[model samples]
Target chain A: MNPEMLTKWLIRWGGTAAMIAVLTAGAGDGVAQESVAVRAALVTGTLPLDDPNAAAWNNAAPAVFPMSPQVHWPERIQQVTVQDLTVRALHDGTQIAVLLEYADPTEDPDDAAAIEFMVGDKKAHFAHGQPMLLVEGGPVNIWYWKSKDNKGVDLWAKGFGTLRPHEHQDVKAKGEYANGKWRVVFSRSLATDHPDEDAQITPGQFINIAFAVWDGRKDDAGQVIEKGSQKAVSSWWYFRAEPPPDYSGYVYAGVAAVLALGFQFVLIRKLKEGQSA
Target chain B: MGRALIRPIVIMGAMYAFLKFVLPNIPGSAEIPASLIILYLLLTLSGIIIFETLSAESKDAFWGPMQRFLTGENIGGLQPLRYGILVLFPVLVGWQTYNATAPSDSPPAENRVIHPAPPGEYTGLANPVPKTPENIMQGKGFYAAFCSPCHGANFDGKGPAARGYNPPPANFADPTTIAMLQESYLFWRIKKGGVGLPIEGMPWKSAMPRWELELPDEWIWKIIMGEYDGAHQTPRTWE
Candidate 1:
């Protein structure tokens, strides 16, 4: 082969290589942004499926629901038990915080059966270990007392991010007891998953919340009678977030494209080498 | 040089063919790869130039293949240009389809309206209808305060907590579902909660309290028939 033919061949190869590099970089950038959006939606968005009220009541009621005293708890008994009811959800978009206050609904409320909203699978304190900062898409559980532990109160709740939370603000939770009845302010904002179900706690969606108290009808031992019964409360709240479009599934599609491009680049280089060989 | 190029190209091409045909490909994945698409565009333009230049040498046959330089026009078929188009079409289709459909999956909207109870013919057990409006009103009030959150106001089974429920609540208004349950079923369900029951989310795990103290036995019947299960008897803060 002459030097002239070799030179022409080398120029064509260099031009193709440069064009391939430019296309790779351009396509790679567009796809990376797309991938982030996809992952966020998959993890965070998919959880809050329906209106918290309907979703909680229709699906979660059997575990924790409200019924006339005429009906008893365990309409559908399962192996798992939910107790010590306390739940919360902060709707940042609306700037409302919601808390589910579980109490005996027998006209007279239960004073002794203090509601404990704890975190972890089994704890009696605050839900999610007294979260220092509210995690947007975190879930928390609760346990309650029915008549000084005559029977126990148990429940589970999952909190999701409806509005992007303000990480800067110190999460200030409060409790109040101004009225004749014991009214503990679980939160300041109606921001739970099922705020509507809570006659008192609104702007939140409801989950596994069991309310129990001394029925007041006691036995001869001077002790509170009956297993402090528990019931589920079905409720909902309205929450909105910025249109999911701004960020979208940019990261996810981006990653897919990136990996695809990287794979293509490597495969093509190998292919070209193999052809030349 | 011919042996060097042909040996590896023929082997790799055969492997590509085999993998493409034999593998259980992921849906939408085995298309014109991006690498192949760019290569196709380049090759097509290059082919036009290469063919035009090669054919110009044999002015009588300007449309013939470039291989005419090494093999007569009757010898080698036009294989290079043919391969380029096959690889290009799929890349275009895939990129376009992904863009068109990705945004369609949006987060669901929130619903706040309460649903009502489902009324249907009882096949199992029947409760005698209450005699007066007072009874109906009592039933309404009882359900409004208690049952409404889960069963919904209209009893169509679209309560607030409906989504997380597996085997979502039976749409009470639907005759198909209502016909399945007897008055006794509602009574039994009302009397005993369904924590561990076969009912959807009520999975034998969580059951509501026995409200025998809050309400009288008869009011249970009223709430069942009156079906104000989805109304807010008390003011909800988040409404």
Candidate 2:
């Protein structure tokens, strides 16, 4: 083929194809941002609170993620034993509940655990050492649990290192250890008066959450080190909440637009030929 | 000479503009960065010009000057122009590519200086182990386990964990890098590590751990030797 004719044909077809792809891919950009998709199960009845073998959780697929050792204090620890964690979530119109389960060879006598939730639209750094509640700007809600105290506390933070317990707790937690595995549940209302302070989790919207777990058994010299400071004492991972059923309409629209452009280009070329003749 | 360059230079410049302005915004297209597009266009066009000049039709253009002047005969007016372009075009494209892509050979800036000169005992310390096949093999094993995680298996600064660090790990493959330092200099750096590196900017930010805490003095020397021999890189010399 003549180089000029070949170049012209290549440009027209290639440009049209490229335009269609970019528009289609750009439309579903938000869907791509979600790292973890926790399906919001349509629970018609009461959620099983105490039952470990609940059927509602059967539909909720587990998202197993690895824990990364804290990077801040490289001198304190070189490696961490707690490597894997599996999480599942379900929602009943009014409340959202998440189940976090992880394996531990030896359950510490302290049996202490903490989970943090950030309630905003902005992307989170989920950095190590500093409290994520502080790294997440506006407000973050934290739930702290200890088996020795037999109590869980709800805390709030607004900046880098500021963490304070709320006068009233907003999170309820129940935990159990069986066969060297720890399963804990955290549940809260869909809507709350302190929307600013509480993470307003709703179906179909994606929000960022950071996880930190401390194994008291791994502590050195009776000093239980966890949270903030990248060491074996603490570990962090970032998970973005995604609702069930993938909806990508932009990709379809992009295909339709490309077809229309191709049709129009042919029509225009025919008209130009007729006028020249 | 100036007149002979006009056509090729203009064509190259236009090709650059086409790649930079028109290519990046094309949807569904491989969106190469503007700088990369320019480099690609220059290299390609220069290659084509050279390839086309080598053909039978352009033979007079390449050898015209020698044939015409020696025979005392005036051939076509195109021979001088073709010879000039054939001689100059490749050098121009090669120089541009080298300038754009090659690593800067200048010494590190003041703020980037991780460690200064050695004080007393570390000045002339040499590697105790001879560069026998066994010792080099052991050094290679140790380096793969430790240094390769951040310094990269190829001794480039692009290891898996090297991404987030502020100042990236040293690339041993760079000729100006480890090739400039002595064995004793490396020994001090390995023993004292980043802690010995004084706080100039953000202190304690050095990702390098003091190997003294992790490995003995013998292994450090072995790692240095293995890197030079294994990667086949030129060692730094007093000369």
Candidate 3:
């Protein structure tokens, strides 16, 4: 057997193999990549995070980072600091969420946590046991705020497994913002059959929310609204995406392409020999 | 037989690498970075390679390399650029597909356009909303009624409540020389509220009902444009 003939076989196999490999990998990823649609639009919302008595202005809340209901990846909220703080409620028809932002949470020398908010002029607090009201029925939202900060470990509220309230599951969360404040939203997602239900939502609803953040404590001097001096919630909004498809299609298509290409190559080779004869 | 098998393997590796950069950027793709592509490729490549190695081809060889491989339609004399362009085929297809499907943002929520306020001092209105001489003075009044509390009287963003706010009020008088916004810029900001600006930590309009409702459009314009302008302090005439 000639080594030169063997070398020729090797290169022929190598070149064909490379093209096959490229198509296989290319098609698989291409199919998967094509399914996705990427987007990044500037999302802005405001929430209150300051003391009631510390008065220069109490009405307006600045735009907060890590805005509401978007689940915060474990320690992702403490990335910013707040010089002054404010909190505003955002009411998406079904529920209320919060958005928080702050002074350079990245560059600060203070004792303040990454996120904080004043509920009734006192530091707002939430944990596993508390329950905060989400809406007043004044406004309607298209979708609820799921966790916006998706950590690698989990699919978070919307994409992966959700904390569905089969009976009375504890749904507790603390909203930290790029601003320096840790706000806790501890609520329980009651059962679907529960009577206290405001409204049920199909998977993909609108994401607009309008919050009515008030002192939840007492009212100041002159104000028409029910609660405290300065109170307003952030605008409403939601996010949605169609997930990627399964890979079974790739397997079948790949198998067929290879088989067909092989059969055709063989048929052509035989036909060439037959013509020569 | 051998070439066909190699095709999928190498293609898979390169494809894995390229897609790694693409996926994580898909909006909310769990901040997982691109380096993870290498990890997935390693784990997947090994498994795939193992699977293919056991199933080698069972056929005799075909024509040798010396036997000319030609285009039947036109005895093939294609240019290098042609091949180069073909090489870029996958990349171009991927990019075009992304562009078509990717979510381009909605035109920034019809920005708050500040229609020149009704003839006030700036407009020199007959009502002369406030008794101030300059719109800057009216801006002071306008801000005092609204913005100054959180932002501060001097626009130092040091209002009395300035002590504990996340993203303190923007220092309008920052001597540091920031965005040299135009005359009507402040009015647009004030009226539109902070629907999408960097006044983080404070709620939009900060309880000052969309000034569109609270102040006559004129006053909101006077307060923001007048008092916030650099003309009084920096000596540069309002361009």
Candidate 4:
């Protein structure tokens, strides 16, 4: 065969092999996330404030976020007691409620969980908020719940070791332990009276959120373990109240298609003129 | 002539699929930035266009079908194909534009130097500790206590604390990371941590704790060796 024919054969076989490789490999888009946004499904009537196994929760989608040990600060846990937390959210126009469920074999007195949201426009660091000296916008609104109290406290924090209860305690919570799992519900108003201290939940908008859990265990002597910053925590995730479907995206897509077709017509006219010439 | 017209498109599409999809799925492979992928495709397309149009015969071979299609010439039995192209091309363009312009919650693209130049003083410094088995064992213990929380017990940078970190921890198992850097550079990085990065490493939000304050210099060297052993990688030689 001639050199040109040999080159053609090589190209043909090489192209076929590459096509096969691509097809067999499959299109695996490796964009992995630890947790998806916890969408608060819109519901009518009263929200499930205290019911963990309520039938209404089936309407909301569940998202499980992997929890890590709080190892950044001096008081940190070396071993992770809680591996992950399953979260579901629901909104009743007036109030928003979130259910946090995690697995723990023992129910010590210190078994507690908390959900936090960014208080300002700027995002703070997810782990215990950001240091105030280094940067601004580190304030967070925390809804803290404990099994011992069976209640939730509305708290605020600017950074590590700065957690303080808010003057207006607007958050409420209930907890139930069954089947070796702790299910806690934290509920608050969608629009709080104190926006400065609380993270106002707006429909159709995403808000930065994080979670922390303290798994208390007792020794043979029945002494409660020290559970402070040494707890299982999750990085920043998103919480958004599901909004009604809008048709704006379809309109934008239609306009773009029309513009592209118009450009193609101009290209066809240019090609026709060239052919005539 | 028809084959020539489709060859370049096929090549471009295959390359895009490989870069955007196949590469990331490969174990121990870092993600190729979308901007870098676009740059590569543009360069490949430009080269192909220039080569195809180098001669009159080749130019005719390459553009003849395109010209005919646009001008609606000699499309005799290809009426359905012509209509299909007319509908699909605009829709494809619209879909691509929507994907590019749509709002997403994913973080914005970041451009930062991964391995910046070490300072002159640290460049000549060598590991003070010898690579003994006992020392390595000690280093492994220290790593489990100090580094494993974020760098991971397996040295793959997926430690439990690694979530939500924008840059994440460095995966030593990847050849592009520790295997590519000199031991001195690793020493400086470990000693100074993220706060010690130069201006080129801006937006320095790395959660790496500075070990110089807590660990001895000899222990740091041992930990470096331990990291290499854990990741099954060797430090880059000066030679």
Candidate 5:
């Protein structure tokens, strides 16, 4: 075909392909960000607390986040047993539950998992909160679950060495270990009475959250190999109790589309006038 | 309506896809930031447009189809296509605008000096440790013990502790990073780490620990040599 005919033919099909590509470009997971938000899907019924394999969990999407060794402090662990964490969350308007799952080769007594949320409006460094001397944000509220205790503890931390239990222990958790994997579930009320100590989970807002896991590998004498800061950790990710459907985004986009069409029409008219002149 | 008009747009799109998607996934490639991508595309578009429109015949070949399409001229069966483009163009623009204006939970992009100037005393300083094979081997061991936790054993910066930190660890394997820097600058950065950066390295976001207190000066020099060797790059010369 001649170049003119080829151009016309190409334009006919290529234009359609390009349009489709442009429309779907947003869907591509191009590059991995440092951390992506873990959404807490809204559900109509009660959350499946203490149940990792509950039917209700199927409604929520799981986000697998990479975990790294804790190398910030002097007692840091260079190697990490847990390389990634599978997290799922659900909220039933009043209560929120999070399910944490990871692979563990051994079931020593020291196996534990914890999730931390930024307490108040300020933002702290992801590696536990900022140091107490360099505290630029509010404290971090941690919900810790241990395999031995088979329960969760509500704790608060200002920095690395300042972890302490909250006055009101409102968080609850349960763990199940089988076939070299540990599935743990932590649940708490969306809003707590203690505003100063606990992180309030409000709908339609994003909050910073982090995770840590201890594999509980023990020495020959039965001493825990992973202790204190020697564990796998994740940086601050986002947690949001998804709000009700908002149509304002669509409305704005529709208006903008109409305006853009009008601009194109105006541009074509001007071009025609210039051609005639 | 010849290939002249459509070629530039197609090239731009292909370049964009390559830079935004294909390049980052390559084993040793570094990601080009969004701002840099836009600048590059703009330059490429201008260059192609200049070349295509330089001659009268080529100019007509390039602009004829576009003008005809706009005026609904010789295009017979493509009338529906013109309308299709009219509708799709607005939607694409609107979608892009919406994304740009949307409020996000992710932190705002930060600007920091990738390689700030070293202190006066440190600028002229030299690596005391020789770059012998044995020294390089020792440096490799030191790097594995200290740097590999965050910088990665492969020097790709995907170390076990690298994921969580924003302004993630530097991939020394990328030519744009270690290969472009002076040995003395690397020495200064190693000794001081993140806390030692000047004001331009704002937010002090680097998680690099100061090795001055822990490792001796010779060890730091050795680590630098090992880093260059492992990344298969050479330090920039003073000349």
Candidate 6:
């Protein structure tokens, strides 16, 4: 075949294939719809390691989410104990840090506070266990922080009561209580190769995240200290990671489309004589 | 055969892409900006028009068989079909052009009249705390924590999350918005929230969550004081 004929066939088939690929990849059906949307603002400057008062976090956007009581067996509570949760996240390419601030009537002596955040593949289902909150059949990473402990425990679990401590501790947390409120900061690397940790975060991509708060208040009896009970469990939500500095996905899409059209037009002109074929 | 398949594939594929990838990604729900859809539709329609103009004879090759089947065994039966196509084609083009160029702030059918009335219990209620500079500053902090995500830092209804909500959060700056409503009404709305909205019109679809138990009464009142003072706009009742 001549160069003209070869080019025309290539354009015709190539354009059709390209369009199909773009449509299928972009249409993510199983991804959970955002019940709550959190925007993790991009910060280029360095953040204070292991400290909450980082200058880089000053300009971060704050997201406030409602904390409802965990109404399930062994931990059923009719009334919501906690009121609201305000969160802010900042990333400077190397690390992603989250700051959470919420009001607590009084600080519990035994356990100050705890936070559990789940992040994994978009297709993964977030299951709230009747006895505990955990996903079924694996791939849920839980970061548990307690005020009394020097460091927090990272765990990987699949189902109810299946949680096992992670091989290595990856998440660092700090908690400060003052003026009837607790402010906590959690930080970790943006991406990691750890088997138990699914830390793949990219700009413009949505990831499912939910939070559980544990208030360590005790009842009248000293034996009844709910040392680490989840007082509130939030519904599944999503946060789109800050897009890269050169975020031009739309521009690329536009240019690719225009080139596809130009290629189609050229092929049509060249194959006009073969139209009857 | 190859030429015939290519155009349909491209057209349908492009439409699929627009509906799937483009439409869902556009910021708002009920307030979907028509400009993007309009542009895509116009471009696809123009592509068809260009192709039809170029392949006048071949145009019949695709449409002729279907047209014949639709008007089978009837003399001059295709006249209505041709006339119908001729009339509807321009109407579709004109509608798309209007939507593409129309102002986004234009109210929806249900937004024609959305005046909310406070309940009897809440009618006479007012902020008990005095609005000192410190109180106003504290109110600003509460507003930033709870309301700023949707209502915006300046209460302009252009917050980051505001783009995702329909009937985007009320703009306190607008004369017809909080400026016209009393503090009692604002209090009731914040406490009861979207669920408390009158069951009439599109008000029921509001995404505003009830903050009654979540936010303290002091903070709620403070937010009201802070918003009006910070924005330099007076609340309706204070006048």
Q: Tell me, by TM-score, which candidate is best.
A: 4
Model 2's CAPRI class is: incorrect
Please, what is the TM-score per model? 0.28, 0.43, 0.32, 0.66, 0.65, 0.44
lDDT comparing candidate 2 with the true structure: 0.60
Top candidate when judged by lDDT against the true structure: 5
RMSD of 1: 20.1
Residues B1-239, candidate 5, lDDT per residue (tens digit)?
A: 56887788799999999999999999999999999999999999889889988999988888878888887777899889988998899999889877766656453445678887778877767788877999999999999999998999999998878975656789999999989988898998888776566656642345677678688999999999999999999998877
Worst 10 residues of 4 chain A by lDDT: A129-138
- Candidate 3 per-residue lDDT over residues A208-232, each given as its tens digit: 2222222222217543221211222
i-RMS for every candidate: 11.6, 16.9, 12.7, 4.9, 5.6, 14.6
> lDDT of model 4 at residue A2?
100
Best by DockQ: 5
Stretches off by above 4 angstroms in model 3 are: A1-138, A141-206, A209-277, B1-91, B102-142, B156-207, B210-239
Clashing pairs in 5: none
- Tell me the tens digit of each residue's lDDT in model 6 across B1-239: 33564676688688857675776778784333568667767787777756765776767765544444333323266667655654455455545555554433221234323656666887868788798999999988988877776678878886654543444578887778877877788888887665455534233234565578487887899988988886678767643
- Of the two candidates 2 and 5, the one with more favorable DockQ, higher being better, is 5
The order by descending TM-score is: 4, 5, 6, 2, 3, 1
Docking tier of model 4: it is incorrect
Candidate 4 residue A245 C-alpha distance from true site, Å: 1.6
- Superposed on all Cα atoms, model 5 deviates from the true structure by an RMSD in Å of 9.4
lDDT of 4 at A81: 71
Model 6 stretches astray by more than 4 angstroms: A1-35, A111-137, A196-199, A223-230, A247-277, B1-239
